[model samples]
Target: NSHRVTYIHNLFQNGAATIAGVSEMFKERKRRGEIPADEEITFIMVTGDGGADIGMGPIVGTANRNDNVILLEYDNEGYMNTGNQLSYATPLGHATSTSHVGPAQVGKQFQHKDTIQIMAGTHIPYLFTGTESQPQDLIKKAAKAQWYAKNYGTVYGKILAACPLNWKNETRDGRNVVDAAVNCNFFPLYEIEQGITTLTYDPEAKGKKVELEDWLKMMGKTKHLLKPENKEIVEAARKEVERRFKRLKAMSEHPDL
Candidate 1:
């Protein structure tokens, strides 16, 4: 049977909650034995940002026990179709209707949610993460995920795509955004196989550490976070980078033990 459920988080948009509710419904059906134990189920999560579909991560985490979950994150940080409201995926200082900048000038006060980390922590049997910019990598990850699902029972994959309008960039510049992501190490092209994390394309394996400026320059919204006058903000951003590196180090040390 096919069904769709909608979840509304503070009425921000219908995308996130919709995906979450549908997954939940299927799980409920399976638990009650309403559906045959052998029946196969697949949950498709579609959202613009990491924050909108936070529910999907855990659902995939739990549902992977008996089903397949595919997550797609459109790089648009805000509610693009809904008057461009700021979502949790919105970058640190992007000016949105909800986060308007005044004379005092402060944009979204919070950093965007890292949905990848949330899913990675789940330690699912099969997890694949890639960006749409790398079509080859994306296809490879998707194919492997399907293989795992068909043969091993469950799989989970996440893809990141560019959102030009939300990022105040031209649609024609989508490729540029992807290139920036690679150049800045903001979005590396990689895949997780059978719970093992491996870097697929490490152009910087021997290169210098990616600086915060690389990401900030491409993301207009995050530019304010580096205002020279705000020493505290600058230091905070640096600290965040250091913390991220540490996490990556930990992941590298143990991919799927």
Candidate 2:
């Protein structure tokens, strides 16, 4: 059997796809033998953090959107499509069009939302993180999303991308910034399958685990935090990265999770 692709606009302007609606469509497809009983159908939704996070309702809807639909997040940290405004995914201490840094104001005051944990909390079958830094790893996750290798539920993946124009970095160095983000543990690579968590990329290799400053200095968006007087904010960002990675490490060790 072969699969088909379709696009639905007005997802927000008209109405977000609900559980009942998606369930019925897949049911009908299978009933018509359009989807083979032995072949798992792959339903994919690629969106941005700012738009997808407007309400948890969509996230909840996605969790129950049959045992298919994989949501891929092209996480650009800020709303790249909207003049680099701050989104929930933008890290703290990073300056954006919406979250500015000045003598009195200090970039974004909040840490990026724990999106992965939120998706994980839904008890979805699979959750993955990939970055432009590692093209091979990203490709593997994309393929895995279609296969449902171990479980039969949602397979979500987040791709950490560096915006050269927004980040005030050279276009040629965009990939390097992605690599730094991974090595700094700011956006580590991993996956959760059937409640079993695994760390796909280990940053423990020699010179692999670098200080968060190394990552921060790569992009001008976060250059404000590197200021001598802004040491406290810099430390806070570093601590957050460390804390997040620690939790991920624990999750990776517990395969029975």
Candidate 3:
């Protein structure tokens, strides 16, 4: 059947959570044959800024049990459609309309949510995290995801798109900004295959341990997170880098039989 069931969660702070709920609702509907089993089901999530959209990852994970779910995270740092409010994914120091800066103040104090990591934790057979700035990588990953969904009947891919308004840059500067991120080794392009993580590109030619400065400079929002005054935060960020590299090293060395 060509009929497509599209669920949109609007004005709701937790859109992802809403999606999860709807998936359960649909499951029941499908079981009763209210919707034909042979009909193709597609679940698509669209959100702007902030990872506060709860239930999104879980819904994708749940939907994957019987259908394919595609998740897209736009680069909009502020809630554009909803009066430029800050979402959980907003970076540390960006001056969002909701998170305005004043005397003796920092912008958004918290770091952005790592949705990729959250999705990875689900251990989905076919999952990917991509950015539109890297067109070739995005296309390749999308193709792989589609193939996985077709073969295994479940796949999830999270895409990162450009947000010129949030970045305070012109649309034309979007590519340059993404290029800077890649060149600086801030947004390292990589992929995970069947639960195996691989570094796709490394411009810095550094060791397994990546320097924190490379990524920090590109994300103006998180600059304050690494400031000298925030010694603890900086140290914590470094430790995270070390921990990730160590884990990757172990995985690379020990392959599954």
CA lDDT, every model vs. true structure: 0.60, 0.78, 0.58
TM-score of 2: 0.87
- Misplaced by over 4 Å in model 2 are 1-5, 11-23, 32-41, 149-151
lDDT of 3 by residue, 14-127 (tens): 555555566557668889999887755545556654543544654454544634445556645566666667876665555677776655655666666665566667666566
The residue pairs in collision within model 1 are: 6-17, 6-18, 7-17, 7-18
Clashing pairs in 3: 17-54, 50-89, 51-89
Which of candidates 1 and 2 reaches a greater lDDT? Answer: 2
State the displacement of the C-alpha of residue 198, model 2, in Å, after optimal TM-score superposition.
0.9
Residues 81-103 of candidate 1: C-alpha lDDT, one tens digit per residue: 76777877665566777787666
Better of 2 and 3 by lDDT: 2
| Pairs clashing within candidate 2 | none
Quote each prediction's TM-score.
0.70, 0.87, 0.67
Residue runs of model 1 more than 4 Å from their true location after superposition: 1-43, 54-65, 103-105, 206-210, 223-226, 230-235
- Score candidate 1 by lDDT: 0.60
Higher-ranked by TM-score: 2 or 3: 2
lDDT score of model 2?
0.78
